[model samples]
Target chain A: DAGITQSPRYKITETGRQVTLMCHQTWSHSYMFWYRQDLGHGLRLIYYSAAADITDKGEVPDGYVVSRSKTENFPLTLESATRSQTSVYFCASSESLWSSGSPLHFGNGTRLTVT
Target chain B: GIQVEQSPPDLILQEGANSTLRCNFSDSVNNLQWFHQNPWGQLINLFYIPSGTKQNGRLSATTVATERYSLLYISSSQTTDSGVYFCAGALYNQGGKLIFGQGTELSVKP
Candidate 1:
């Protein structure tokens, strides 16, 4: 596929366990982001990668780790999953950082539940 | 952090009716985008209007950067339009990270 794809469409893990969500994009976009969606909060950014090895934290980066070893792959890891961390996760990519014409393309999303 | 608020959190419209959703941001933004999250939880890009106006099919969006707000207009609504509409804005020096509003949930009944 030419667009972004997220793995394990749905996941359920126990608290204190580690879980990794994978995101892959074929467009080779320079910017990749991970967001978690909750009821009142629309989408809160967990982490983002500017390039292959450059990454930064977003609004909500606590307890979540992200790494981008390659331009096409950006994975989000939860070192210790908690019930509060159970939410739908979305992976997005863009060509430019803050350009007007560059809009984000989101994946189908991964629904994670921590019990 | 900038605040992003959306109006009319929930809306129900009949097919063929028209509706408008509004998004307000607390600060100036360099990027503004409208997205439609379908029932399957897929976020589809609706418009990438930082300023000015753009139309695609029966959907159109207008963003007035100076006013710090954006409007998404959905015309001739269809059942397929039922979903959550979100607007995200990025500040000038935020490294392209966007802050999203709560979103407007629309249900189109046929």
Candidate 2:
């Protein structure tokens, strides 16, 4: 497809288990981001990648790891999934840093539940 | 870090009515965007208006960076417009870090 896609739209894992959320974009955007959405919190950024091999933490990065080995893919890993991490995860991509009229395109999102 | 706040946490309107959503920021921002999270949990970009105004179909947005706020207007609301509207801003020195507001949840009834 020509848009961003997320894998395992729904996932249920036990606490302390490891889970990985995959995000792939066909546009080859330079900037990719992962966000978690809960009831009161609209969306909190967990991690973002500027380009291949360059990533940084966002507002909420604890217990999460992200890697961008290619321009088209960015994956988020939860080393030890906790019940607190049970939320909807969204992946988005932009052509560049936000200065150049680049609006983020988001995937359908992954709903993860930790029990 | 910049703080973002949105007004009217929840709203319900009859179809064909009009509504407006507002976003306030604590500091200067270099990037501002509006998104609509559909009922299916898909976030669709509505606008990337860091400044000035832009319109698309029944939706329009205006960002007054000097005022540290933005407004999104939905004209003749439809059932499809029922969703969570979010506004996000990125600070000047920050490396593409977006701070999202609490969001306005809108429900358009027929």
Candidate 3:
């Protein structure tokens, strides 16, 4: 498909266990981002990558790690999932920066529950 | 960093009613976008109005960059329009990284 895809549409893991969320995009967009949504707080960015090897932290990056080894894929890892980390995770991508009229696109999102 | 704020945290409307949602940004931005998170949790892009106005079907949006705010209008609302509407923007120097607002939840009753 020519759109972004997220694996394990829904996931349930125990606290202290490690879980990885996978995201793949067919558009080869240069910028990829991971955001987690929760009640009251809304969607908070966790990490973003400008390229395969360039990544930066966003509003909420604690306890989470992200790596982009390929332009088409960006994965997020929770080293030790906590109950507080239970939320819906969204993966998004855009071509280049905001300047060229390229709007962001998001996958269906992954619902992660830590118990 | 840019801060985005949305008004009318929740709304309830009868089918065929029209309503408007507002978004305010803390500073100037290079990008502004509107999205609707469907009941199924899919984020669908509604508009990419950095400034000016744009319309699609029964939805329309207008961004007044100079004033640092945007507005989304939904006309003749239907049951399908019930969802969370979000507005996000990237700070001028921030490139494409978007900061999203808390969103306005809409419920349309037939």
Clashing pairs in 1: none
A1-115 per-residue lDDT for model 3 (tens digits): 6999999899999999999999999998999999999989878999999889899899999999999889999999999999999999999998855654677899989999999
Supply DockQ values for each candidate.
0.73, 0.77, 0.66
Which residue pairs of candidate 3 clash? none
- Specify the highest-lDDT model's number: 2
Q: What is the DockQ of candidate 1?
A: 0.73
- A1-115: candidate 1 lDDT, tens digit per residue: 5999999899999999999999999998999999999998999988988899999999999999999889999999999999999999999999885676678999989999999
Give candidate 1 regions above 4 Å deviation.
Answer: none
lDDT agreement of model 3 with the native? 0.92
For model 3, the DockQ equals 0.66
Best prediction by DockQ: 2
- TM-score, chain A only, candidate 1, equals 0.97
CAPRI tier for the interface of model 2: medium
lDDT of 2 by residue, B1-84 (tens): 899999999999999999999999998788999999899888888998989999999999999999999999999999999999
**Candidate 2: segments with Cα more than 4 A from true spot:** A99-101
For model 3 the TM-score comes to 0.96
